[model samples]
Every structure is written in structure tokens, then in C-alpha cells.
Target: MGRKKTLTCRRWDCEEAPFLGGLCEAHHEEDRLKQLARRAAIDALSTSCIAGKLPEKPGLKDELLRVIRWWDKACLAVNAGRQDNVLLDETQYAPEWCIAFADAIIQEEMNFRQGLDDDATVAFLKKDTWTRFEHLEAGFMSNGVKRPGC
Candidate 1:
């Protein structure tokens, strides 16, 4: 067997340490506790915001699923080093930013639909939620808007 290398925790300060990827057992336990606490808080907020009843808004649900799928694929690529960088160059960043903005708008529409009792507004909100992604995708720099070598 190869010899083991000694290491310190990556967390700043204090001598209690473990190999490479940081954290002694105690610190690792602490980190897990903190992470769970934060996640619980976020879950509480989401439940409260949705009135403890998350409805099946088809359009918003579909978009959320789509975004989740994209994120999963991106994460896989990142882990495999296929997507090595977050390109924040204007051409790449701008369209992505616009897409995020549009997604927020759709989320607002979904929230409004859930909160309000207006039937007319609900249909319009649903339409807006469905169409926003297309509008955002269109904003992406095709051959025309893209800067060279990007």
C-alpha cells in the first residue's frame, strides 16, 4: 500500500484537521448540522410562501422541471470537466441573464395565479409563463449577436 499523506482542514484557523478536502470529523459534523439547518429554513419559507399548499400550475411546473433538467445536465458536464468554465463574456452571459429574468417573471405570474382569485388574469398569467421561455431563448446570440471566437 502507498503511504498516506498528512493534511489540515481547509476551514480557516484551528489545528484540528483531516485529509485534503477539509474538515476534521467534528468540523464536518458541524458543517452538516449548519447545512441541514439552512435547508430546513428555506423549506419553511417556500411552504409559507405557497400557503402550505403547492398547487399544480401546469406551466410553472413544466418550466421548473425543465430548468431542473438543464441544471442536472450542466452539473454532470461540469463534474466531467466537459464544461470547464462559466463563461461570463457578454455574449454568453447576457442571454443567460435575460433567461433568468424571464424565469423570474414567470414565477411571479405563477405566484400571482396562486394568490389571486381573478380568472381572466389567471389565463393571461399562464400564457405569459408559457411564452416567456421562448422569448428568452430568442434573445440568445445566434451567429448574428455572438462576438467572434466566443
Candidate 2:
């Protein structure tokens, strides 16, 4: 009689024997939960996001900068197979849509910062733009904030 080969779990960094669907018990459960939460993972849906040019109001610009930073990083993460971010996953949105939104947001950020004479704003925009999204660095978040999203 020939010896049968042991099948290993096909997930990254998991060498356990296959439990179901070629994944180990833990991975299979994780995938199952992910499949169930897929709908809520997308809070909204749209075929196209215009991301029309940002206006020049201080509050709007400050807020939109945060939004732009988020979408930019999320799109990059999705492209790099790191869809764990809030951006639409590969299964939900098209690559063209992702790239289009990213481009619009980048241009919008530039528009917001291009006219600023302050050196801190310029340096932050050019370099640490990502930092602003989380902690609101280099720019002040205004009060009485009211956007369509909120």
C-alpha cells in the first residue's frame, strides 16, 4: 500500500491540515464570518463616485482633507491585497472606480493646500499628509461641522 500525502492548510502562514474548503478549522471559521459580514462591510453602494472638486471653505477644506487622506490610504491598501481597511473590497468595487476616486481625492487635497502660504501646512501636505487623517495634525478641525456624511 502507498502512503498518502498529508494536505496542508493553504492559507498564509498556516501549515495545519485542511479542515474544510482547503483551509484549517480556524481559517475556515474566519472566512465564514467574513462572508457573513460582507454586506455590512459595505455601508453604502454606488457605481461611480464623482468626488467633484473640493470647495475652498476652511471647515470644508479641513474636513475634506481628512476624507481624502482616508480614501487614498484605503485605496492603496485594497490594491495591495489589504482590504481590511474601510475602502471597498475587490469584490465590491472595480479597479477603475478605486483609481478614479483616489485620483480625485489627491487632486482635492492639492487644491486645499496649494494656496496656503504657511510653511507648516505646505510641509505637512507634502510629507505627513497621512498623519492628518488620524490625529488631525497640521490643521485644525473646525467645530459645528456638518457634512452630508454625518
Alpha-carbon local distance difference test for all models: 0.45, 0.45
Question: Which digits, one per residue and each the tens of the lDDT, describe model 1 over residues 15-113?
Answer: 676843478777788888766645533432333222244435545444444544434444455555563132212223333332343334344545667
Off by over 4 Å in 2: 1-5, 43-150
Query: What lDDT does candidate 2 reach at residue 19?
Result: 93
Q: In lDDT terms, how accurate is model 2?
A: 0.45
TM-score of each: 0.33, 0.29
Report residue 74 deviation for candidate 1 (angstroms): 1.0
lDDT of 2 by residue, 38-113 (tens): 4322211121122344445345445434445554565567667665333323313433333333343344445556
Error of 2 at 111 (Å): 34
Tell me the spans in candidate 1 whose CA falls farther than 4 Å from its real position: 1-55, 84-114, 117-144
The 10-residue segment with the lowest total lDDT in model 2: 40-49
